[model samples]
Target chain A: MSEFLVLVVPMWVVFTLAAQGTILSGRTGVFNVTQEGVMALGASVGFLVSYKMGSNLVGLLIAFLVGALVGLVLAYMTTQLRLDQFVVGLALFFATTGAAGLLYRQVIGVTMTPPRVDTLPKFEIPLLGDLPLIGDALFVQDYVFYFAVILSLVMFWFLQHTSAGLDFRSVGENPKAADSLGINVTWARTWSTVVGTGLVAVGGAYIPLPFTGIYTDGMIAGRGWLVIALAFLGGWRPLYVVAGAAFFAAMDVLGQKAQVLGLGIPHQFIEMLPFVATLLVMVFALRWARQPAHLGMNYDRESRLVG
Target chain B: MSTMQKSETGPGGSPPVAKPEARGPGILTNIAWTVVPYVASVVLAFFLGGLLIQLMGYNAVDALRAVLTSSFDTSFGMVETLHKWVPIVLCAYAFAIPLATGKFNIGAEGQMLLGATGGAAVGITFSDLPMVVLLPATLVAGVLAGALWAGIAALLLVRFRVNEILSTVLLNFVSFKLIDWVATRVWPDAGAGHPATTPVGDGARLPLLGSAPAMHSGVLLVLALAIFIAVAMRFTPTGFEMRAVGDNLRASMVNGVRTSRLAGAGLVIGGGLGGLAGAIDVAGVHGRMLEGMQSNFLILGIIVGLMARGSMLALPVVAFGIAVLEYGAGTMQLVSAVPVEMVLVIEALILLLLLLSDLVRDRLRSAR
Candidate 1:
């Protein structure tokens, strides 16, 4: 159980960070569908930079900047030009996905043996690390895991307790109302999307550091899509998202271990657990998953339409 | 929202309706308006792609030239391009059909694989049957399988209010695992040295046309289907309802249109077309279900569908252009050492530019 938790935690970080990023932008009416592509770009850039520079921290920072660049484009197109959010998001997804592969292939070439970097070192908390089964799994972990925990707490507090957070949330619930109340709709959307997208990239950058220490094509796989589902499953709430990420991460780890578990079932079916479970969960999740009212719709200040 | 509606209405939106005297020059200008943006976007995308190639230390001219000319330079290349066109266009229909009802189907890869698996199952089970009975059975099975696969997502969206995009995308991941099991466990072709099923019976194969490097008859079938789809979308009541729902959901619902049902039907039809692409590949090209057979067609199809911008008539044409770029990507790599991904990047650039062109056109029109 301890070993399983150890495996689940890092995967949890990936889900938590990405889901948080998704909801952050989602709360501003900017439904970011580019997580899959942006995450892949993050993985490639992170892996390459880590391999070349010998510093995973620097790699993650650069990944965040790159993801922010994409977010900037998405924000400009949707917020300023009033383009269709989903369409522009889909287009950016394609461009970034292509760019990820292009950059990796150009930098690494066709390497017979892919270069590797050292995984992030773990640091055990003094008193917490000495506890029972949960101790090693939860307390003794990498900096990113700790960061995910604190970030979630910070986000929950910021959104729930702060007056500024209410102003921000108002943009997604009713942008025209927010604008009428003197809140800067475009500013809220742009900053949130940029930072939110950057966090998603940071989540992606974490993927290479935890297990493989190398990046490959399709490494992000459908995890990026799963993050969107996670956001919905959590009702766009930070605390619930953290808990939901644990469930997704467990499924992820279980899928990876299916071949070795020897459960008398085909490993393929086991590998499909996360996606299938999400599909099933969504049927119920949507009942209470109150997404931002204007999610996936562009806000046109000059338009007479209610949205 | 305005951009999507504008794109659906075509480049300039239904020319003034009251200007009978202006119709003469209006027709020419309308044609110019449509043609110019497409041409300019393509050129600009290529220019950007060339710059990237040069920065990457490759010969941009050679890479760009190879990408543009290779499909026409040789008969084999042309045949390959046409073969690529078969799946690309079918997948574009898979995407565009649903978009007509304002639903996005991102599970074409999964649907195609399931279709192939279904076709292979039928073909393998009825290996001894005559072609007259077996071929159509295989194809029908594929279509049904594909439709069933998408129906799950459609059902969720209609009955439970689940997001179609998430459901469709998640189903794709599920389908990937499902097909892997089918190929490896159910009909494993041990000799193929890959996770693949055995080839279907000879009766299931599509007939070949012309000489060496001959084309398969599936191309002609898709050509016919394309014409039918274009006419149906423009003239049929169901198509009109789908368009109306997409253009304005509230108005459509107010007017007694069953918006949800129409959206569900669009997904099922789109999935059926996606399945046909897989089945055609089995009959015409690969002759077996195999891993990786989906071959980036999902992305190509989406790009083409978006480039067509909700016009069913433009899908096949856009798909053909994409197919040319896809077929030439390999040659460009060989000639100038530029990666195939560069073509994808270029295609994406073209899509972005085309979208930007809409904004520019809107701005200019308002100014005038």
Candidate 2:
């Protein structure tokens, strides 16, 4: 129905907007594909705190903070220990995934009921919301949507205009040059990933608090990795990244439409379209994308590669 | 990572550090040095693991005591450990072969899954066959499936210059969905009302070893495979060529070692062993291709491979260590009010410490 489209499209855009924040972090060279884990951690923490304090806002803040802390640990290993970034990221994934599943199981064992939450209600600006299609799409949404939109704008300004942004960019592009200039290359990566962690956790917290209204294992699934891929597809630009996310949102919302539209694919295969498309795009497009020269290198002041 | 930097190295501060001869040392000193770098790390991880148990408001000693006893004390526990270790050993050997040949294989899990599926299918389809005929066929089918799966990555790498790591991982996603399809559509087990194949018939079940607890002939096969890999790596011309290619591909090519063939051989053999592990798991543990049962199982293989350090001698020990950790985590969940997330936290800390310690060691050596 048109009503369903009216509802789904806008929410889909907001999800994409949130994913853009993740892509920005990737562009900044954090490479913390463990975003999914951070998100899950935030979801659990948010659920626990919101349940305890009866304050959804507080839960959101806690989720952001906790997710960042987990990122810091990841940053410590990847930045300081000089481990293989991919393996570190994968290990992070393993630990967090198992932890998330176990935590969910312990909390909701054998309980058939989806944990309930009084989700944040939607708000409408008095005048703009009155516009026929555009107004409703833009203005009438939950607090998370507006927050994400504002955050996107702020990030766009910050990444482009700030001195710290220049240092961060230098650290990503050429670590040797950054280090020669006395910029703490490790610190920049660590902080960017920390912020990335917070953003991802915010994404995760949305699930239990406002998105799904309950906790479930593998709920974020590979959306975290998708965010990483989406970042590259967006060319790490904020606006394009959001668009890329919306494209996925459309796929997500339309996933069930395969049956309705008689696309005649297995539900799983249809569901895989967005990810497969992204992977192919990434594989091909990656040949063209210029990476930060030190993208996943672990720098030890003492050790040098013979080559 | 926190080490003083003194970058100057020459007559003022060095002892002709550049020469190949300078790298050698007394036999005892060399052994001591290699052992020293790892000792602190392993000890630190073990200590921290204990500390975490204490931090969880439980007696660390009591928990570790139980774990140690469970892994070693009773014959039943010993058999359980060996039983659990067999698949892990095979999986590590499967991964380590290509890894030694300078290939990164993250698809061990997916390969194992296919092995399980393929072997189960063959076994179930031929359930009317004699036990001797059925069992070996199932395992062989698994090994072939694994090799064939890995062969895709190998073929692409050889022909198209595709990145094997990325391709293998992507293939994992494909395999997972394919698995889901199989569990849901092709081989639904009506009894469980869940995604899984029909229960494998008794003919496919592995024979237990002399009334030992869960110990099967698979462990003996694992031992034989370990000996085979170790001997191959140590003595064979094929292994020397593979090692030469790994050390320096261009140099080895110039020296007339066929790098391509070596790569193909390594990958095929690795995948075959991984397939064997999957087959063993199906025939020995689950008796059916069940969904969710193999989650994190491949990870155990990875951990074992890393800890093995390309040494087959180390594979059994690494596998045993992982089995102890896994069994401990399982036991803790069953017995205590402690959350199973504690196991995840412990594993995370262990990996974190492992990486951190290696970095620290490198830094310390440079400082010296």
Candidate 3:
């Protein structure tokens, strides 16, 4: 159970960044569902290079850069094309899913062949690894785990206090007003969207690390949508999102623990804990979760509306 | 609210040059607006696919031939098309009905799963019952289960302003898990080494009619249901109210239409219809429940709904077309070394084109 939360914390950070991106881009009039596809694109890019170059450092770099690139394409499509966000979200879902599966199969072939990866290893702090419980869960972990914690705080500082954060929030609140003040609606959304997608990639890639090792085709397993829900539950608040992630991870862990308590229920349903919890969050938690006013709306610069 | 419509783009600086010359709402015109978008979307999608094939150094003609030849190669291929269309047609109508009233019931996946699980559970449990008793039971279970599941979202929306998309999508998670529980714990088939549920008894199955290439009496049921729904939409008081509420909530409310109740009714009816697809799938096709059974069905439902534009009559035709593509795509896969993920790529291209072309038309309408 503890093992699960430890795994989930980092996952939440990745999702938070995604949620934050939506909030940020909501300011700029873009909510891209291309996260799922972009994450897979990053996974393939990161996995193939890391596997070939046999360097974890290079793999990490590749993951971040490719994530940003996927974000850029999504930003371009939603902002430039004047397409519907819902459809964009669905298209990105299909594109990434099909592309990842196709690419993975092309490279790996029909056999249930396992692709190789020497994951960046986790090291215990000099004395921390021996502590009662906390040490094992947090101190003694992979580079990914450490990075997950740091990134969460970094996202917190970046979004809440930064000048760029103000611009993003302002953009989401009123794009026409933001545009009048020369807020560069397109550029802010583009970059934030890029960062957001990059974060999603990081979240997705974390799945195949020490937790599950080699990647499966549908390894993402709908975690992307859960993150979208989580963003809403957290109200795009950095700390609240963290709490929400913990709640999600805890429910999932509880489902597994139920069997130990001799519930004798279906194990399959038990594993479905996270998904169920996400639904609950969306249903009940959304009331408390604050959403940006201009979220999921497209802004046409050519037709200005002075409200 | 009518006054608020002073500007279509939300309280604007100008009323904008009024240029929507009444495209005299012709029978052909309404039909053209609805039907042409789908054809255009598909064509645009494949055109993009051709570009992709060219990029791959593969002849576009060969790919096109493969896609076509694959869909209609053999009797089995024809059967495959029928099989896919069964649910696609049912689910498309299921989605479109609710959407027509401006309710986004994305929970069709979850609803279908629940209805399927309920229907399958009854079928499997009473495997020994005579067909006379079992068949009705399966259909009833499916409709009731789907309605029950959809009720959750409807209740949430009417009671608490819960966004249906968020709520329905979440419910999908609940249904997915519920099905998993049934598959793994209560009814493990174990016939194949894989983790799947046991197949239902033969008595519960829906039989096919005379040599109709997998077109069972279920097709008649589908056709009957479609026509009935079309008539209901065009002439019924309930249908008119539903449409009115869908088009403008405030207007419908002020006009004394029971907006929330009507929305709830749409949810129930839509959900019941969705579950019917799953019921038919179990009774007409697969004899047992399996994990991830309705996942693809859900996607097809969404695509078909968009293509049909909320028309009950158009659902089956659009679904049949989708089935043909699936059949063709699958057959091509057997002969060619190409992976089947290409089918989804085909679908994505089609949908993307459909959406893009629609955007252009929307722009043109606004521009004029």
Each candidate: what lDDT? 0.89, 0.69, 0.70
Candidate 1's TM-score reads 0.97
Every candidate's DockQ is 0.59, 0.30, 0.42
**Ranking of all candidate structures by their DockQ, best first:** 1, 3, 2
How many Å off is the CA of B75 in candidate 1? 0.5
Summarize candidate 2's per-residue lDDT along B184-234 as a digit string, tens digits: 878788788778898777889888777646578888888887787778876
Interface root mean square deviation of every model, in Å?
3.3, 7.7, 5.9
lDDT for each residue of candidate 1 in B32-112, tens digit (9 for 90 to 100): 666787788889999999998999999999999999899999999999999999999999899888988889999898889
Q: Which candidate achieves the best DockQ against the true structure? A: 1
Docking class of 3: acceptable
| Candidate 1 residue pairs in backbone clash | none
Query: TM-score for each prediction?
Result: 0.97, 0.85, 0.88
Kindly indicate the candidate among 1 and 2 with the higher lDDT: 1
Worst 10 residues of 1 chain A by lDDT: A298-307
Assign candidate 1 its CAPRI class. Answer: medium
User: What TM-score should be assigned to candidate 3?
Assistant: 0.88
Restricting to chain A, the TM-score for each candidate equals 0.98, 0.87, 0.88
- The reply for model 2, stretches above 4 Å from the true place, is A1-25, A101-114, A125-139, A161-163, A253-265, A286-288, A300-307, B1-24, B36-39, B101-103, B131-133, B151-167, B201-203, B212-214, B236-269, B363-368
Residue-wise C-alpha lDDT for candidate 2, range A42-151, written one tens digit per residue:
77777767776788889889888887777787788667655666567766776776666655665566476767666777898899888776676667777887887777
Q: Whose lDDT is higher: candidate 1's or candidate 3's?
A: 1
